[model samples]
Target: MNWYVVYTKPKWEKKVAERLNQIGIECYCPVITQIKQWSDRKKKIEGPLFNSYVFVQLLDMDRNAVFQVAGVIRYLFWLGKPAIVKDEEIAIIKKGLSDSNVSDVSVTAFQVGDRIKLESGVFSSQNAIVQEISNTHYILVLESLGCVLKIKYK
Candidate 1:
């Protein structure tokens, strides 16, 4: 079986993953917990790490099964075909999130136009360019992934 990426409706990653699992479809929706502050109080909440995205492992013939779940929009496509994520990549994501050493990870500032290799975190081992930076977040262009990531920080 191969792992395929599924795109979900906005903020539906977790729900879609849960529904897929309930129907015996193996899926993965990586999540993270963070503190959210309200005007009156602060609380910890868990949210999908990659917004609107989930990974499912299944045979190509079973691809249509995922559509039965609500909020699943479609399979992500790359180069005119369903985007396939390697098993090793999935394993690495799981391992990185589970590793205790990653708990203390922090973001550092980078000069615009600097080429950098990510050492850890979700895009670990990937090369990216510091495209832009602002007070709240920074943008990174991961050429290999063919995506621009805008990461926010305190």
Candidate 2:
């Protein structure tokens, strides 16, 4: 059985994983506990590490059954084929997420022209491309909205 990535509907990662498991399909949806602050209080919430993607371990024959699950949009493909994720890489992600010292791992080395998804703030879930990088912040260009934003990472 190889691990393949499935894209889920918005905010459906956890639910889709549960449904797949009920059908005897091994699924993984990595989540992290985050402290969200508001003017009145702070609360810890669990959220998906990758917003709309879930990993499933299954034989190629089981692909049809996986697609039948509600909220499962489609498989992430590469070069006209379904992308396969290695077991070792999945294990590393699980281990790193479970480690107490693992606060934040850089998803990618940000380079100019690389597209990125905003994980939080008012522009949460928006896509932008890196226009420039400074010592402390990134200058991103939101192409669809025709605007640029400077974001600082903590």
Candidate 3:
């Protein structure tokens, strides 16, 4: 089994997942929790990590079977070759998602002395040491400042 990208029809992401499940195609669609505001109050819900594409694992021979699923527009490919996601990367992502022995609030772990770089933000392309880590922020000691900087970067 290998990972392949599936293109869903307009506004049919969930429908495609259901159809694929019915036909026994293994798929992965990670969702993040979000809060929705209504007139009176707000409610929490899960939303797709990606808007229109989902990953599926299936045998190479099941090409036609995949295209038959409702709401599946097509398999993304290049030069007649199916787009493939590496199994190792998929395993890492799944393990991170399914860690039961963890805190209620997800906290990304960072090494205190590990060298790291950031891109696209106020500190774009800056290297720093992770001095401390919070649930939603990184307390990094910038190379230039030599003092700790509390950055709310994901």
Candidate 4:
């Protein structure tokens, strides 16, 4: 078993993960907890850590079992190929799951106008100015500290 990055269609991370799990293939779709505020109440919800990718473990399974999953785009790769993930790291992750509050760890879509706050590390106070956006994390300009901090959009 390994952590192979699975490409999925838009808004289909959960669907793909579910389908893969149904086939006896283990999958890890990391998610983050979010709090939504309404008129008078705040509710917490879980969302994907990565917007369009999820991890899965495959064995001698036929391609039909994989390609048939709903919303599956393909395995992430270069030169138009399916890239395989190694097993050691996957074991590390599984170990962490044994005793941690592991959230769905996926890529985050950091966009403009998204308000953010410092959660930890050096500049854990001053507001984070979203200077740039990327696939995995957001590049923030910490004005108070006079340095740029690239924080994972967790």
Candidate 5:
């Protein structure tokens, strides 16, 4: 059996994985737990690491069976064929997400000349160029306003 990638409906990764499992199909959905803060309180919740995508290990005969499950959109194709994922790649993804300190995993790595946007705070929605990186802050040069701001890394 080989691992193949399947696309699911929006926010339906878990549900689709469950349905596939119930039908005796093996599937893997990598998720991570994070603390979500709201105005009233904070709660730790599990969310998909790869949004709307799930991996399934199966034979060629089971292809149609997987598609029949609810919330399953279609198979992820590459170069006119269904993309086959390597077992080692999937294992690495699972192991990385299973770590206790997954929160420290940087989703995006910025370089010296990369363009980045401030997601929150006073400079929210503003674009800036990465100039330097200190141990605790990012020195970004905002060319539009002609100012350099050293924003603390969250």
Candidate 6:
């Protein structure tokens, strides 16, 4: 069985993952705990790390089994086919979340020449220099990865 990326309805990642697992399908929905403030109080709430996305592992023929659950939009596509997530990538996410050494993960505004180190994801620990910035995204030149990365934000 291979891991495939599943796109879910907005804010449905955790619910969809729970439903898929209830039916015996292996699913992963990474979550993070943050302090959310309202007029009354500041409370710690857990939320999905990747909004509207979950990972499911199943055989190619068993792919349709996920659709039986609610809020599953579709398999994320790449190059006209369902996008696959490598097992190592999934492990990285799990390890990052479990490792207490990793902290303060945030997407903040960066200047054109600021140097930053990625705290999570595939590029964790890699140093990148900001090359460009915009309202919705930023470009980084990852020296160690030897690649230019464009990250979209809102």
Global lDDT of each model? 0.90, 0.90, 0.75, 0.72, 0.87, 0.89
Superposition TM-score, candidate 3 onto the true structure: 0.58
What's each prediction's TM-score?
Answer: 0.70, 0.70, 0.58, 0.53, 0.67, 0.70
For residue 19, model 5's alpha carbon misses the true position, in angstroms, by 0.8
What's the residue-level lDDT of 2 in candidate 2? Answer: 95
Question: Which candidate would rank higher by lDDT, 4 or 5?
Answer: 5
Tens digits of lDDT, candidate 4, 27-122: 888666677799999999776766888887766455446677879887786335456667776666557655457644444555775667887677
Instruction: List the candidate 3 regions with Cα displacement exceeding 4 Å.
Output: 78-80, 99-154
Give the candidate order by descending lDDT: 2, 1, 6, 5, 3, 4
Query: lDDT of model 4 at residue 140?
Result: 82
Q: What is the lDDT of residue 89 in candidate 1?
A: 95
Q: Cα deviation in Å at residue 60, candidate 1?
A: 0.8
Predicted candidate 1 versus true structure: per-residue lDDT over 58-129, tens digit per residue: 999999999999999999886568999999999988888788777533235479999999997899999999
Query: Relative to the unseen true structure, what is the C-alpha lDDT of residue 78 in candidate 3, on a scale of 0 to 100?
Result: 46
Q: Write the per-residue lDDT of candidate 6 for residues 65-132, one digit (tens) a residue.
A: 99999999999886568989999999989998888987644434468999999998788899999999
> Which ten contiguous residues of candidate 6 have the minimum total lDDT?
102-111
Among all windows of ten consecutive residues in candidate 3, which has the lowest summed lDDT?
100-109
lDDT of 3 by residue, 1-154 (tens): 8899888876677778878888898888765567789999999876565677778998898867878877788887744688898998788767866676632334354677767887767878888888877766778878875667787643
Please, what are the lDDT tens digits per residue for candidate 2 over residues 1-154?
9999999999999999999999999999999888889999999888899889999999998887888799999998855689899999999999999899987643546799999999978999999999999877789999888999987643
Query: Root-mean-square deviation of each candidate, in angstroms?
Result: 8.4, 10.9, 10.1, 8.4, 11.7, 5.9
